[model samples]
Target: SFDVGGKEAPKVQLTKDGKEVKFTSVEGTRHVYSIAEVKPEHQGVYKLTAKNKTSSEETTVTLNVTGMYIIQ
Candidate 1:
């Protein structure tokens, strides 16, 4: 969840690897950005932006997917 810190809610968007990613809210809340599933293709840098008429703020995160094997 992210805090926009204002009386009015900010518009939010998410992008992965410089491309726009589709997201949904788990509930009817502005703080949640939900991706239905995670796959190998989903591994990349993700950016979240919150903007209003007056100002904007951004945050970024990296997702790395690794394989795990069971040894016999």
Candidate 2:
């Protein structure tokens, strides 16, 4: 979790490969909020952030989701 001023930090927006995933009811969620939707296509280092109207963070994370084997 993060704390930011109401009019300081960015409203923060999350997405996966350009898909919008709203994390908050606020707007201007740019490099502020840590937002992303993990999907089968999302296999690699992802960006994680948290922002408000004040300040934001920039980080990276690896997403690993196992899948069932498909037998012939």
Candidate 3:
């Protein structure tokens, strides 16, 4: 999850391994991103970017999947 610290609402974008990916945004939330039902193929470097009229912010995270199966 990420937070936006600007006056205006920013456009959020999420990417995995340099490719654009889909994320879930719940209603009434500011800037929350979620990936449901994670799988082994989902392991990669994820980058999130939020840009508004005045400023922009971004972050990166790495997802590593190990073991037989993920419970949740």
TM-score of each: 0.73, 0.36, 0.72
Better of 1 and 2 by TM-score: 1
Leading candidate by lDDT = 3
Per-residue lDDT tens digits for candidate 3, residues 19-53, read 98876663543556565777789899999888898
Give the per-residue lDDT of model 2 (tens digit) for 1-72: 333345564444455444554444443332333336645665655454557655776555566766769999
lDDT order of candidates, best first? 3, 1, 2
lDDT of each: 0.74, 0.51, 0.77
Model 2, runs deviating above 4 Å: 1-7, 24-45, 50-55, 69-72
TM-score rank order: 1, 3, 2
Model 1 per-residue lDDT tens digits across residues 1-72: 544556676777888899987665523444565556767877899898878888898999999988778999
- Report residue 7 deviation for candidate 2 (angstroms): 7.9
Between candidates 1 and 3, name the one with more favorable TM-score. 1
By summed lDDT, the worst window of 10 consecutive residues in model 2 runs over 26-35
